[model samples]
Target: MAGSDSLFGFGKGPPALLLFLAGMLISNIGRSAYFVCVTWIALTWSNSARLVTILLFTSTLAQFLTSGVSGYFADMVDRRRLSVSLDVVRALVVALTGCAIAAKIGIWVLFLSVALYSVVDRGYLTAMQSMIPALSRRRSAIAANSASYLVMQAGTFLGALLAGYLLHTLPYGIGLFPIAIIFATSAVTLSAARTELSDPTHANSIYSKPRFQLRFMYHLGRHRLIAPTLIYSLGFGVGFLFSSLLAAYVLDEMKGGAVLFGQMESAWAFGAVLACLLLISGAGKLLADFGLAPLLFLSGTGLILLWMIPGPITAATLLVALGVIYNASRILMDARVQQTVGITEIGRTKGAINTAATGTGLLAFTFIAVAGDTLAPSDIFAQYGLLVIAVAAGFLLPALRGRPRSHDEDRSA
Candidate 1:
């Protein structure tokens, strides 16, 4: 019954916990569509690889440098106000980006606006993540996280579809209408969530002393922080490489075009949605730590196989499997973080974790920049595969011996 309660998100928090989840799904739809439009427009407008790279790199770089600070603010501020304000900011930014495109604005303007949008996006996510524990008990937190990510992934797929439809059939400026509306809806929906998310310990103590205080350092060293951090870094970093290389893989290796590429993306996003669905089931607790190592190993094997897999149909099918494996790993790892940390520390813990993951992502991008020209897309996929397998190997021993102790356990020892 407890598991069932958690599965449905009927925890100790306000009823608006359900509202929070709904807002996540809705906003993500807009977020995903807006990014797709930005990327597509940038490529169409510039037709320059260097410019596109600069745009994307700016967004990633902003996250790498400031995720920690954003998380810090997420913790210190009233999370409800912080999150709702960020949602409004996002809506405004998305609308503004659309206007820039419609008006034929300077490329530099697009760059600056998207970079600012990028910063706000990361901060909004950190604030929302920190709110999960603030709204639920441990069991409920896991299920809620699973639910949260499920909708978010589904939103991504929906948004991609919306972008494709609008781009293919409608005028360019039409995209501005729906995105702004979606985010505004999200802001209104989430604002109704009543909860006290700020930590008094943080506000009152010397530990609250701005960024990188002694308090954060102490939590940074803990295993609770380390576990999720490593998992996120590997999953996100490798996943980003996959997204970047996938187009080339489709074009060159599979001899496919936009149609096949779209189909493959659908399959992958579908897999992620399916993963979250399974994770939110009655067996949610078992789902969090279950099969994580094996999932990574399987992901590596699939990536390696792509090095030789030849058919577009076959490639798309394989992506379905890989998507499930990769996203399940991400969702479960996120749940583990929520399980291990308390309301007060979850913000900074997540911030540090995201910083590490972004650093890993940037490193992956650097590797591509430096070596991408010489390597075939297949070769890059195999290299990423090897990295995943290596991470899996490291987890293999610990997984077999049984789940390692959390930081709290070490402290009690």
Candidate 2:
């Protein structure tokens, strides 16, 4: 997968590939900025653990609602054009959000902007998800995915680092305006990436026959592997989103204010970076071939262990270790699924996964919100840990009895 044939099925050179990679880099940066900015804003506005959980959960809920529609359109329409358009749309939304925040807009307006941003951002990502298969060979699919994940994760790590530094040096909310610029740059870069038609026969225009039907979603949910994979994915999402609130948790319980919390977040960012690197070096592939279920189960277990730690050093170490399994399972499982499902159903399946993930996240967040109000911090983690264990058991039992022999043989053979 080195030459133009590797880059595009049509033997178009490496320039487009480079451009595509660059585009993803910037997009990931914008996404990372929003994550950091939003979490910081929530922390500043309200210290209640429940409020933070709801805010975080609401963002994903918005995406879950739109992911199906976006995936439908991505597969049905001209994926490349749709991808670029979504990026531009994301830039405009981010810019408006920055302007609104700077002008002291109402809290509702800010919330709306954040919600809208999540939809557009995920819409573009869904498009990009479909495009990876379209742009590469069958064997190259995993490689392209791995490369994209690495780039995306690296961008996020850097963006979070940069944003955290800015927050420390400048006044509060200053990072938003600069983050808008990053989104704008991403949109332009993505648009500039030439979309060589996959089929030499198809026209290179944006307008295409619109295909909308409820069956796409229905069929997606009905697929044997996809449906079960999605259930497992939902569990994974719940654990990940729950763990992400650790920063706020630390601020409240660990005697660390904003500054110390930021540092811990930076640690999380670096941990993610390390995890991505490990996956890119074949750790993910190994896990996919060996024990995806156990890996995922342990990932959740790691989250529980991390929360149970008494000191910062041990907590940080566990957090980083948790990060490793979390991302490793994600990369490997997604790659395996994509390879198994093939390109035809990629969008539908990916959309289903996204929808389930977002939906699960929303439910978990809602629960956390209610629990946050009533339970002590330690109690909240303890209860969530139990939930994670139950979910992990669900996946582990299935893996033991119903391994993806059909899917694995297809990939291996």
Candidate 3:
């Protein structure tokens, strides 16, 4: 009876929820630090931009390649234990990598180590996602995810904001300390959390040989849920890809450097934080229940404008608006995916969905950083905006066609 859902009325109580938020905040702080680490380290080491992007790409590429396998293992494994151990390993790996960089180790070795860390890091996240549904009851799923995302947005903004200051003031080697500390904290918190009650649903597996792998390709081809989710991911990723190129447009072509870039990222982060706050305050449920499609269309339209617009002030305004709407839509869609899919295929369902998004990012990064370098920024943004609009159309038209006769009605029917 003590282990039942009465404690929180629906799912986990205060203690488990606190731990969950802490874990996500710490993990996301590490991720945010790592995202900016490449450019910072490159500046300190006098490395090529290509090399920096290559290292970042190496990490994403490895994660993309292994994501499906990681998801499969997540469904089969003891996710909490797997998550805890991996965090510990990641902390040690990152600390050692930091030390090596401080000592001026071979660049190739540094890259290889970071790549190895990426695999572990992403693998742990996959396991964690699989575990969340187990830790909390079904009714609390949305709250849990919203809380996690809020923490993540805060952590990411704080990390990136601090990194900007630290790279200027502190030595690059010393800058990695915060990342190490966060992962260490995450490891400790998760290990302690293991002593709590294990939910019954997740208790049955020590690697069940689910028909997942055997029937994976067939399910992917036939599943109504998976196909639409992939397309939606593609649309979102394309929008983000265009946004990434927009940054280059501002810095190089707009003739504004650090000052403009800093302003834009800060504005973008602020909007994200404000949006998350609104969601956690119960405003999001109102929006979700009432204006889902119109809001989505607004987000897409905002992204299109954000990409094509010139001038730092104007573009930043558009980006702030776009970022908020985009994140809100993402949260809604992700929840829908979980609700729509068969429980047995959750891992592959999400993995297939994620794969397309991350892959699109890789493609976009490669194209923008490489081709945008050769072309005019105006031309790049113009072309990129068109591409994003085209992708968004695929999602928008169908949803409209399937839209309920009234706002109060469910769109899924």
| Whole-model lDDT per candidate | 0.70, 0.63, 0.61
| Candidate 1 Cα misplacement greater than 4 A, ranges | 1-9, 12-14, 46-53, 106-110, 194-202, 211-218, 248-260, 282-291, 372-374, 397-413
lDDT of 2 by residue, 1-413 (tens): 35555642213356666767788898888787677766776666666666667667767788878877776676666766776777777777766776776677755655687688888887788777676765656554445566677777778767767667766776545667677778778768766765553222142223222343334455344444553455356446634454446656677567776565655655655565676676556565565565555555565566566557656777667656665665555556566556666455566667777777777777777777766757655555555556667765665564568765444222321
RMSD of 3: 4.6
Q: Could you tell which candidate, 1 or 3, scores higher by lDDT?
A: 1
TM-score of each: 0.85, 0.85, 0.80
Q: What TM-score number comes out for model 3?
A: 0.80
How does model 2 fare in lDDT? Answer: 0.63
- Stretches off by above 4 angstroms in model 3 are 1-10, 43-53, 106-110, 197-211, 214-223, 235-263, 283-300, 342-344, 369-372, 376-381, 398-413
| Candidate 3: clashing pairs of residues | none
**Worst-scoring 10-residue span by lDDT in model 3:** 404-413
Model 1 Cα shift for residue 401 (angstroms): 11
